[model samples]
Target: MAASQAVQAKLSFLFKAANTQFASCPELSNFYLHQFQKTADHANVPLADAVQRLCCARCGALFVAGINCKVRINSIDASKRRKTPGRCRNRVRITCHACRHPTVTNGSTTTLLKAVASPGLSVSVAPPVDVPTGKKTKKKKLDLQAMLNQKKAPSPSSSSFGLDDFLSSL
Candidate 1:
């Protein structure tokens, strides 16, 4: 337990240092962030949700909203989500600008909405269905000959226009 506390203190210090140095020297900040992760891993300590949200999983870079990352809220349709057992109701997507890697974190709708609606943070809602990420659809074979032979609607003739007769009567 003493070792865990030491590791926690070290992690907090590293995280703060990383954030402080990030604006002036990003490389050094990234180093600190990497060290933070390494220390946590070595101590077998799990990172808190608050800490995890501000770090990039790919490059170990500090995530600053709108500066180094883009944060968006993805809401799943209730009916669709219920059909899929493993899917989350609401997902918060944080895309790291440095590596262009997107990390998705699932949470309650109210909490995610509150986080996104906070002042100074830009919020964008994703489409209900992400079509591109799903499986590719098979193209159906078209019967050109059958389509060409199909009967078409008759075109209206000039005699069909009774406006001239109507004007003459008026």
Candidate 2:
């Protein structure tokens, strides 16, 4: 289901307020964050990925690296690595100081890049361009209206054939 725009706006405001008050008043920031989570849950709307990563799922506290939470890249265990050398990879772990909950996520290249770049920095990727290949020079656009207006074929099971006819044929 689609999210309500009004609820989305409210969530944005709450997150911003929590972020702004985090340094000066941590309690107030936590309160705002708690409310933000509650509002999203009440409205049955999903939080944005950025916001979800920033907030502590256990305590509803804002996670500022080195402040409220500790962020690190955890290497695979020696035994596990030995069992599967090539498949083993590091994982990004964020531990909440307030709740002592550790959240582990994949240590992808893009995630490492973002962590090393800067704090509170937004990363945006440009839309992919259709490159000219020998087979196709241009991208084909779908006609949504025509597709919607097309008549759908009935299923074979929906045909006007009785069970008695099948038994007789058998």
Candidate No. with top lDDT:
1
Model 1 lDDT, residue 112, Cα: 54
Ten residues in sequence with the least summed lDDT for candidate 1: 133-142
* Candidate 1 clash pair list: none
RMSD of 1: 15.7
User: How would you encode candidate 2's per-residue C-alpha lDDT over 1-170 as one tens digit per residue?
Assistant: 56688988888899899989998999899999999999889988877777788888878899889988999998877677557534446778899999899987655544457566786776678989977675453322234544544524334666665675578699
Residue ranges of candidate 1 with Cα displaced over 4 Å: 1-5, 83-89, 110-170
* Candidate 1 lDDT over residue span 86-129, tens digit each: 65687799999989989888757455577778899868888698
Question: Among all windows of ten consecutive residues in candidate 2, which has the lowest summed lDDT?
Answer: 137-146
Clashes of each: 0, 0
